[model samples]
Structures are given as structure tokens and as C-alpha cells.
Target: MKYLSFTTNCVLILSFVYVVNCANILGYFFFPGKSHQFVFQPIWKELALRGHNVTVITTDPLNEDIPNLREINVADSYSVFLNHEFSNVRRESTPPYKMILFYQEVFVDIFKMQMENKEVQDLLELPKNAFDLIILESHNKMAFGWKHKFDAPVVALSSFGLPVFSHYLHGNPIHPILYPDFLSEIRECTTLVDKVESTYFTLSCWFVVKFLIGPEADALARTYFGNDMPYLDDLEKDSMVFINANPIFSDRRPKTPDVMEFSAILPIRDTLTKDLKQILDNAKEGVVYFSLGTNVRFDHVQGDVKKNIMAALGDLPYTVICKWESESIEGQPKNVHLRKWLPQQAVLAHPNVKVFITQGGLQSSEEAIINAVPLVVIPFLGDQPLNAKILKSNGMAETISPKELNRELLRDTILTVARKENYRQRAKELRDIFLDQPQSGVDKVVWWCEYVIRHKGAKHLRSPAADISLYHYFMIDVIAVFILSFYLTFKIIQLVFAIIVGLFRRKPAEAEVSRKKKKKN
Candidate 1:
């Protein structure tokens, strides 16, 4: 009896251990940009804190001393971004074509650099190394190769919302009219010409990804993960979930079951530095927060644009806190304060901040909305124009076209947002909606991630359409068959009608000849 009791206790302990085992997760951040890293870092940190075995291949590693957490820093990829980064993207922001070039030339290079990193190469060499799941950035689909390498589930996270190309993975329909392409600057109530252009641009973007980027990425995947692995195209269909950083206020659309919106994952704290607090406290007429986001440098702005901005801010009565990279402004204003970098969220959270002049990146846009600060958006490139348009449409912001930016326009827009009570009211309303969700964004992510681990790849959540080809999904072959059937039916009907008319004409002629012969006799 004693021996049997001891065995029972041992079995119970072993079962408990099996149930409580921590999942081993691998995260791949192929994009080198800081903005992308900012969205991903919080999630990785949270996973580690929860006692999961987390390993990440990223440009911006946590660099913290944490047990059971490994971060492989591929900082070398930043040089590629620096070399390809262009400041004049505003002028060259043509839809679909320019974006295609940017992705093919710049993003492709960044991914390759990350793949060729010493750590990444070493990891690929070890076929025995395993992971429970692989998290990838949606921008670089090449990272999906890890899905096959580890034979694990893929959870794709997009820092800048889901592009039209990615909708296919979730079996989500691409309704061009309602869901405009991120790069296509078409609003819902645009003109006929704009709608046509938007549709063409949207289709063109799909073409580029399908024909240009997709094939090249497949080749790269083959090089790293080997040809024996599932085709790169098929690998994406195996994704468990798509976590997008797209705020609900930005774009309204119907998402499939597998897509999740966790845009509010970033924590918002109202704390500020002592120096910044003193500055804002001293400003009696409120303050204007200005930032062009991380990539665009103020120093690189054209001379005229700089002069116009300087003059506009110089004339404003409010204190201007601009994120300027240069050591000194050409003509400094007494009311304006220049800083190389400021704690953006902390500054925006202040009650004294009247207006936020932003370049309309997704992260900055969410920050602005959450903090209840009105905006004067000056879009530069990518999805900035669309984001700016959305904010303006919602009555929470105003926009000054880059081409039309002058001292007068800049000053007017800022004044309008700062002085207008309606913008602030609308902004506050959005903030409430954002914060009123049933659970925190972090909690939602943690729950879903654990759910995926428990279910082992979450294959039950996947759609059958996700595995189908584009031709089959759209029913191109079915349409062709119908068209051929209709043509054959029309030809048969035409032949029958011609024969009936010929017979009627011959009968009439025969009757006339018979009547003439009777009269002559």
C-alpha cells in the first residue's frame, strides 16, 4: 500500500509538470527601422516576463539581462536603411510604382542583410534547433521561411497595419471600394477619377507583390530553409493569426476570424522629464508638439520648407517644442524650443499640449489620438497620406499638403487646430473609445499567444480558402467556362434563326410562281 501510494504521488507530480511547461517561442524582426522595432519590443518583453523561453532575431534587441530570453542583435542592417533612406519621399509619393520600388530596393536589402547576419546564418545551420512558434514581421514575408524550418505556427505582426497583399493570408476579401490600399491615397468620398486611379493602383500593387517580390522572396527562402521545405507561398497559408497595429479609428473594415487588432499595445504614461515639465509649466499660452517621426530628418528638409516652418512657428504665440536634429536653427525663435529627441508620448499626455504637428506615421497617429491631442498632419510618404486623410475625415485633425506648404498655410492650420474646440472634443471622444475596450491590448495578446501554444499551431482557426490559389479564389477558370458556354449557345441560336428565315422566303416565292402559271393557262 505504501509503495502504490508513492507511485501515485509521483505520477501526479509528473502530470503537473507536463501541464505547466513553458512554450519556446522564436521572434524574427527582419525590418531594420526603429518604428517597426518599437511596436514589437513591448510584446517580446512581456512574453519574457511571463516565463516563456523567448528568442528573437532583431535589429533592436532588449539588451537586458533576463533569464530564458535570448536576443540576437543584427545591428548591421541599420546601415542599409541609412544608405537607402530618402528625405524627398513626399515629392516622389506616387501610388504603387514608387512603393514597389521602395520595397524591392530598400526593404529587400534590409531583409537580406538580416538573413546574412552571422547569428541568423548560424541558427539556420542547426536543423535540430526547435521552436514552439515563430513570430514574423509582415513587411518582410521572407522571414516566413522560419515557419517551415521549425515546423511551427507563424504569427505575423505588422507595425504599419495590414497591406492589401497580406489580406489573402487570412482569406479576407479585398474590397477596393471600401478598403483602399495603404499607399493609394483614396478616401471613401473621393471623385470618380480618384476612384478609378485608386482601383488601378491597388491592382498594380497586388501585381508587384505576386510577380516581383513574391518570387524573389521564395528564392531567398529556398537558399536559407532549403528547397525540400514547403513552398514559401504555401507557408504563409499556415499562419495562425495576423496581429495588426491598426487602430480602429484609422480605417473601418471587416476582418476575418484570424486577424486581430492590437494597436493600443503601447503603454501610455503621463510622466515627463524635469526639464520638459518645467518648460511646459512655464508656457502660459500652451505648447505645440512637433515631430516628423523617426526616419525623416528636419535637417534634410528643403531650404524653403525649413524657412516656411521656422517662420510659422516663430509667429505663433504658443511655445513650440520641435524635434529638430540640427545643432542650431538658422533663425531661432524665442518661444520655440529645439530638441534632438523628446519623450513623445509623455509630452503629448500633458494637459498643456494644444496641438501636435506630426508626419502621420501609424505609431505617432495612435499616440496623438490616445492622448486627446489635435493634429496638423504633414504627410511624407507610405501610408502617411491615408492616415492624415482619415484623421481629417474624423474631424480630429487638419492637413497641409507638402506641395502646398507655406508659412501662411502652416500657420493657419496650426492656429485652426490650436484654437478650435471641436478638434479637441472629437479627439477626446476617440480616446474614450480606444480606452473602453473589454480588456487591455497586452492582455489580449498574451491570452491569444498562450491559446496558440495550447492548441499546437491552432490549425482549427485556419480557413480553407487560405490554401487556395488566387485564380481559384477569384473563380477565374469558372468565369472562363461560363463565357465559353454562352458563346456556343449564341452561335447555335443564330444558325437556327437563319435557316428558318430562308425557308419562309422560299415558300413565298413558290406560291407566287404557282399563281402566275394558273392565270396563263
Candidate 2:
């Protein structure tokens, strides 16, 4: 097996030759977040490599020169993300409602930008039946209209966690409290206050996404796909769903057969730089790897918080490898090495590395688990907090809130995670489970994508719940019927009892009146 190093992400040399029954696949990954693109890229890349014609419209394109692949680059749309200062949102404790509103507004602008692109406009103008299947991203409905334009089957692709409303498309069960949305901070709650808070946040987001954001997105789809386009809600009824989540760390939910969990084995160049490899090898006291992930950069951290983090790490005897995008961090210790980028998976896989200090992004979490490395999570945004909560519950990690981060707390937590054997033990046990899957690397995705195409859409696999109405889903209407029946039954019984008492009273009165008449006579 030959491995090529490209900016630290490694692609496995898949052994299977799946060139038979090649089909044309069109992928629309419109959400500008790099993390979202990460989930969908591998599937399209593999399909292209396996002799299928794969055309993708994305904000983050592969930019690879592979045969059978055509990429429409729309990376300039990433500027929409820079418009928001998420660091301020965290500090101000922005209410969940406002946060979601801001989220939709930003994404709406991105959609407008991408759809208006010359390439996307031209692609949309293509004749019907242009592609056999369409791969669509979750969270927004603007791109879902492609199914109508192309007259093809669509496989839903969810990054990290499936959106709350998308769960309905596949008929998966949803409980605001039991299974919280990824956007919500409270995944599972014990206290009444926590449960109430969870319910509010979850249901509020659910309503917003389904009613406000979804309809707006649908209208935008019409703006592009023509005014007569079918509602995205209708077009979204998919039989095959691919969620970029593995069972190891994802919240426990009963998923239908159609909703399968898979995380593409993050491909990386196998070789590490000589200097870094030597540094890791020579770390006599093990190594601590710190990174804030792409969405949350180290520099975005509060000045005090960044200082405390650096101080905490510098105090540790272990060597620290930090991923800082800037040229350098002031007052950084000699023991702490700074790099603009590191092959995260490669570094985590090192035996000498003790624990990963991360922002708890799904990709970082998956890689850490696969490498059997314990975690020190300081979550920033999106699903990081939820991922941190899951990791802590599973005993594979120690978590610290970004707001409460300090030198003593960060230092102590890292030491606790590193020194303890159970953290590593739990990681290894879960790693075994994650690694013990059939097919090598991305072959599973390639097979599923083709399976949907071969079967001409798998409506049989969709859950019955996805089709049931809200009135029927919770049996609210059925409960109303029962309540109405019981009320009527009780009212009839009360009226009958009153009539019996009235008849008895009338007979007594008639007897008294008869006595009086006899006496008078």
C-alpha cells in the first residue's frame, strides 16, 4: 500500500475494485463550514475514483486533479462566516433563540451567494435527467430542489449530528428532552430546571428550523429552481441517510435502517516531518497536543484565557505541541512548540502522546478515539459542548468550560487525564469497537451510495414515523379523542343519577299531597 502525504490528511488505498455499474453522481454541499464539507468530500472522492462521474458544487472543493471528477469551486463564500464574532457570542451568553436566528441569516446569505454563482446557475440550467443520483447536505433546504431539477434520487448527508427536523424526513423518533438537538447545550438533563431549559431550547430550535428557516429556504429554492418547484420538504423525503457520526461517541438514539452511521477514515500523509517525529520520540515525559480546531482558532480566545492556557501548559513537564495559526504566541515557553498546522491524526496516533487538548470538534474527537488517546476538551461552538459532555460521560475525557478556563484548572485537568490509566483504557476499548467494522476505510460509503443508485431509491428503508403527521406522531389527536369520549361518558352518568333522584323526590311530594287531601275531605 502506498501513502501520499498531503497536508496531513491521509487517504487509505482501498483494496476493492468497485468499477461495475458506474453511475453519474451530483453532490451539492452548500454549507460553507469546512467541517460540514469534510463529511461529504470523502464519499464523492471515492465514487469518482471508482470510475463514476462525480460532479460536486461546494464551498470547499477537493481541488484534486482526479479523472471522472469535476469540482465547481465556490470557496469565496466562506467570507460569510467571518462576519460573525462567535467569541463575543460565547462571552455575552447569547440566548439560544438569537443564536439560531443569526445562524439562519448568515447561512441564507451564503446560499444566495452560491446559487447566484455563474457555475451553479449554469449547472441548474442543465437538462432534466442529467444525473442518476444527487447527494444533498443537511441543515438547509435550498439545495434539495436539485432532486426536482435533475429528476434523481437523493441521499441525505448529515455532518456530525443529523438536524432535528431532518430526523422527521426519515421517520426517526424525536423527543425534545430525551434527544436534544446538537445546537442545544443540554444533551441530557437530570434537574427539572435543566430539563425545562433543554425542552425550551430544543423545541424552539425545532420550530424555527422547520417553520421559519425551512420555509424561507424553500422560497429561496424556488427563486433558483423556478417558482413552480416542489416544496423542499417534499423533495427531502429520502430513503438513504448518511450521518457523519459513529456510534462510539454519538448520543444513543434508536435509528432506522435507512439512517446508517459512518465516519470516513480521515486520510493523511502517513509520514510526519523528521523534526516533529524526533521531537515526539524524544519527549521523555510524553507529549500533550493542543489545538482549537478550524472553526475556533487559538487567537480568537480571550487574551486572558489564551495566557492562562499557555501558562498551564508551560508549567507541565511534558512537551506541548500547539496548533496556532499565527506566526507566534508571545510569552510561549521553550517546552511549548508552535506550528501553524499539524497533521492532527498523525500526531494523535503517536504512542508518546498522552492526551489531546482540543475544542471537541467531531473530527478531532473521532480521531482521538480511534487513536486510543484521552481528551481534555474546552469546547467553543456548534457540537463541541455536546461532544464534550458525551466524552465525559463515557469516561474518555475531562472537560473545562472556555469561560471558566484558568491556569490551575487547565493544568490540573490535563494532569488528571494524562496520569490516570482508565482514560486511556476506556479510549482503547471504544477504539476497538470503532475499528472493528467491515470493509476497509471509505469502501462502506462507496457501496451505500451505489446501493441507493442501483435500487432506484429505497423508500422501503424510510421509517414510518417520518411520514406520520405531528398530530399522529405523538398521538395527540388520538389522546384528544379519548379525552372527549371520557368527558361525554361522565356527563351522561351524572345526568342519569340526577333524574333518578328527581323521580324519588316527586313520589314523596305526591304522597304528602295525598295525605293532605284525605285529611281535608
Q: How many clashing residue pairs, candidate 1?
A: 0
Residue-level lDDT of model 2, residues 1-521, one tens digit each, is: 23345423433334433347778889888877666677678888989988899999898888889989999998888787677665545412767767777767877888889888898889988899899998878666677888888889888777778867777667776677788777676667778987887788767777877778888888888877888888888788664777777766566778888887776567653468999999999998999999887777655666688789889999998999998876477788989999988888789989999999998888888889889999999988777888888899889999999888999999999999999999999999988887787765367767877888988887678777777788888899889999999999999999999999999999999999999999999
- Give the least accurate 10-residue stretch of model 2, judged by summed lDDT: 7-16
- The alpha-carbon lDDT assigned to residue 471 of candidate 1 equals 95
Number of the top-ranking candidate, with lDDT as the measure: 2
lDDT of 1 by residue, 1-521 (tens): 99999999999988876445578889998776677688888888888888899989988887888898899998888777467655666423455756676766787788777878788887887654478878888677777889888888778777776777778767877778777776676757367876777678778878888888888888877888888877676787677554555444445667666677776547753377798899999888999998998777765666689889989999999999988886467678888888887888889988899999999888898888888999999988777888898899889999988778999999988999999999999999888877677766667776777788778878887777787887999899999999999999999998999999999999999999999999999
**Global lDDT of each candidate:** 0.80, 0.82
TM-score, one value per model: 0.88, 0.89
Clashing pairs in 1: none
Using TM-score as the measure, which candidate wins?
2
Q: Quote model 1's TM-score.
A: 0.88
Model 1: lDDT of residue 417: 94
